[model samples]
Target chain A: MIKVRKLVKRFGLKTVLRGMDFSVESGEFVALIGPNGAGKTTFLRILASLARPSMGLVSVAGYQLPRQAADVRRRLGVVSHQPLLYVDLTAAENMTFYGRMYNLPNLNDRIDEVIELVGLTNRRNDLVRTYSRGMQQRLAIGRAVLHNPDVILFDEPYTGLDQDASAMLDEVLRTVAARGRTVVMTSHDLARTEDLATRFDVLSRGKIAASATHKDFGSGNLLSFYKGVLEEGRQN
Target chain B: MKKIIEDRSPLSLRERAEGEGKTPSGNYLRAIGAVAWKDLAAELRSKELLSAMLVFALLVIFIFNFALELDVKTRDSVTSGVLWVTFVFAGTLGLNRSMAIEKDRGCLDGLLLAPVDRSAIYFGKAISNLAFMLIVEIIVLPVYSLLYNTNLFQPGLLLIILLGSIGYTAVGTLLSAMSVQTRTRDVMLPILLFPIILPVVIAAIRASGAYLQNMPFDQILPWLNLLIVYDVIFIAVAFMVFDYVVEE
Candidate 1:
């Protein structure tokens, strides 16, 4: 349900994403793995309609990027490393506000359900500032899926989470993907991604260097495959 | 000619079926209100933005009181100018702080992700920034009156303050959105904002001065018109360019 071709992103003299192509089918959970500055976030932002590509043909759910961005945005849910939450407002308040923005129906019920899903029902009335990093991240997930969009882009959702938080997030991610939604998540944690994603796409030097299905690992695992791809990228 | 892309609603299919049945324009207005309400609620709770603006505004008036040891006549003549100056500086603080809150934790991105017109985000922020400026103005007028021993209660002057603030925050909101993406956003706002906001500042000062000095209605009319005109033009411009301004 997502397609990109010859995508190029540049900032003045620096070229970040060079003519790259990537695609994902419906209901596929894609884990985009790369090292720092490999443009994983940049690519996802372009798809999320948060950033425009310098040059590209990007479409999500049959809607074009940049041109049909608004329509694409309608089907898109995005969660970045930053919580994108108001610290001064309660979790419930944040959800309510975003719900109103989305013009969601029966928002109170949805907020309760999503808050419960994120396991923040008890703390829903508490200020986000009082919440821990993990709680904030969880609420961020709830905020992202509040609209129940067809596509969700998560960029390093596990960045600062503890082991327990990461584990909890894995469960949440599983639930989100289980709903038959298409998901694209970028991460450095290969093991976690290996467990969650149906496919792994290795992004290196602003291009998708290699891709494989979870089953393709066979006896080997994601780490070795990732390392192998990077080593190949370095050789080329 | 540029291609016109249709804006779409972000409501889920199921929710859209059971939803408010509001028209697109209705959704737009609600989104604007929702954004403005979000800002107001957060500020009301934290008082982080409002308190900082109030302290800075009060401090500016106090500093002016100590710095300008003018006789009653001179103080009256400069009252409008001083008030505009105070509003300008304090309004800058509010604008910067408002956008900073969004930028701090990627809340701006969150706002942008909404399926409404991007201008809704602009209008919403502009409205909230305007409210904060008006609130600060309401408090500052009394404090200025008590400190300088003059009445700032004139209807014409209050109108001028409102119009001036509408224009200030209109342009300031747009600039702050642009500046917030920069590294030195704190310094960037005023630098970008002050020069662009000159027409509003000058017009406000002149009209307010006319009101405070009890100038004839005819004498106040041109400055008054200028303030109104400036407000309309910039707000329109902000509406048109905000999508591009906040776009990366």
Candidate 2:
């Protein structure tokens, strides 16, 4: 559902993503984990069409990046650490606004369904600012998935969530993944990522340093695999 | 070309989303309306944007009233300049906050991620910014009249305010988007906006002064034409380049 080849993203003299090539099949949940300043967020931003690639080609759902961005955007749902929601608007109002932006049909019913999916049905009418951080993050999930996008990218989604909130977000993320949408999430929380992602790709020094599926890890844990990859990148 | 495409039996929104039917181009107007509606609704509930603008605007005029201490003829001569200054400053506040609301929580990215044309988002924002400026201007007018003890309700003056506001917000909306990304955003907007908007401000003040002084039609005609030309040119330029301004 997504492909990137030799993707190099540079800000002035500094290059963040250096010739990184990556891909994900439809319905695959890939977790791109990296330490800070590893170009993980930069890579995801390019994928989300929020930033242009300094070099390389990106195609999502068969439409190319930057050139075919509007078409690509129609299929993309992005959620960063920031909620990307108006705190003053109610959850339902926020949903309705995005629904109109996407020109959704049967928007009211879909809004209800998505609100229920994120467990915000009761608080749907409350202003987003009135909600707890968890509730707001949960509603952010609702906003991202509102239009039934084919590809959803989450960047450090669990940044500030407490334990209970993280658990709730895990449930929401699972429900979204179970719906057979392609998912690419970037984070440094190894334990949570190991629990949720079907495949793990380690990003270090602007490239995919290592990658393996959950089954391929066999009896080993992601922490050890992640450590080995960082050491490997350092040595090379 | 778009009118013909919009007339066809296009796919329903659901189908277009579910399949690879691309953007629902027919919803162009609808997208712009949705954004404007969203801005107005948020502003209505919060009142943060309007209240600040009104306070600053009223403050500007009151400060001018006290500082100038002009006689009736002097007041008549400076009225247009003072009014435009109040508007330019107040409009700056509105434009900055309007885009900041979008950027503060990453809502700008959310807007850009929509399936519609980027220009739709620009126009949507410009329309709402214009509305907010006009709302402040409307209130400022009467207050200026009350303070200055002068009649300020000429139809020609109102028209001049509308046209000047349209030009200001059109260019302001685009510049605010650019400046919002910088670290010194609050300082950046006026620096980028004021010089470019000189033509609009000058033409507006001249035309409005003519109206207030009851100058002859031939005398006001040139300033009026200048205002019209400036409005059309800037609005068109802003429309054509908004995609780049808002893009990363």
Candidate 3:
């Protein structure tokens, strides 16, 4: 569902993603783990068609990025640290607004369904500003999946959530993955990713240092595997 | 949790079945309307942007009243200029706040991620910004007229106001989008916008002044032409270059 080759992203004097190559197949839940400044967010932004790669061949859902960005966007949903919601608007309104952007049919019903999925159905009429951080993040998830997008990208969605909120988000992620949508998420939460991601890739120094399917760990954990990759990367 | 995501493949499948029949232009218009409507509805509920703009406009008018001391004779000459200046300044406040809201709230990124043409987002924002400015201008005109005892209800003057505002917002919207991404966003809009929109401002002042004075149509025609040209050119330029401005 996503493919990139020799991706190079530079912001003036700093190069973030240097010759990075990555891919994801349809329905794969990929937890893209990386150290700080490993360009995980940058890569995701490029996939989301929000940023143009300084140089690379990138495609999402078979549409070339930046060039066919509009088509690509139609199939992609993104949730980042920010909720990307109107604080003044209610949860239902936010969903309706995004649904209309996708030109979704039966928008009201879709909005209701997604709001319920995020467990915000009861609070659907409440203004986003009045909601808790967890509520807002859940609404963001609702907004992202409102269009039934073919792929969804999450960037550090658990940044400020409390334990309960994190558990709720875990359920939301599981629900989304179960729907057979290709999901790529970036997180520092290794324990959660270990359970959720079907595959994990450790990104370091603007490149994917190590990648393994969940089964490859063989009773081991992502923490040990990730540390090993980082140590190996440092040695090299 | 088994039914959390739903089995709406029927709707999506039907949409796909009929997708080929759907025109891109229709989708584009829908996207623009969606964005504009979202902003308008949010503003209506919160009233933050409009209230700030209205209060600021009235304050400026009050300041102008004391500063300019518009006695009857001088009123004709300066009323039009003062009104336009008020609108320009107030419009900048609204524009900066509008885009800044989008940027700060991450709404801009959400809009960009939509499947619509990037220009649709630009037009949507520009239209909403223009609407807010017009609402402020409309209210200000009546207050200014009642205070100064000047008839601001002239058709020609209204036309000039409309044209001038269209041009101002077309450029202002684009510039504000650029400015809000900068470190000095609040101050950056006027600096980036004023120089580019000077032609519209000058033409608006002149044409509005002439209309207020009931000058001959021929005398006001050139300024009107300038306003129209500036509006058409910048709107086109803004529409074309908006994608680049919003690009991350």
What is the docking quality class of candidate 2? acceptable
Candidate with better DockQ, 1 vs 2: 1
Give the poorly placed runs of model 2, Cα more than 4 Å off. B1-25
I-RMSD for candidate 3: 2.6
Measured by C-alpha RMSD in angstroms, how accurate is candidate 2? 4.8
Task: Identify the CAPRI category of the predicted complex in candidate 3.
Answer: medium
lDDT of 3 by residue, A1-236 (tens): 89999999999999999899999999899999988889999889999988999998999889998899988887888999899999988898888788877887767767777887888878889999999888899889888877777888999999999999999989888888888889999999988988888999888988888889968885557888888899988888
Report the lDDT tens digits of candidate 2 across residue range B102-179. 998889998998988888898899999999999998899999999999999888899989989988998899999999
- Give the best candidate by TM-score: 3
Model 2 residue A118 lDDT score: 80
Reproduced native contacts, each prediction: 0.62, 0.62, 0.66
| Whole-model lDDT per candidate | 0.88, 0.88, 0.88
Give one digit per residue, the lDDT tens place, for model 3 in B1-248: 44445443765622562375667888889888888899899999989999999999999988888787757878999987889889999998899899989888788899888888889999999899999999998899889987788889888889999999999999999999899999999988899989998899999999988887778999999999999899999989988999999897
For model 2, residues A30-136, the per-residue Cα lDDT tens digits are 99988899998888888888888889999999999989998899888888898999999999999999999988777897888888878788989999999888888
For this target, which candidate reaches the highest DockQ against the unseen true structure?
Answer: 3
Best by lDDT: 1
Off by over 4 Å in 3: B1-14, B17-20
lDDT tens string, model 1, A131-187?
999999989988888877888899999999999889988887887677778999999
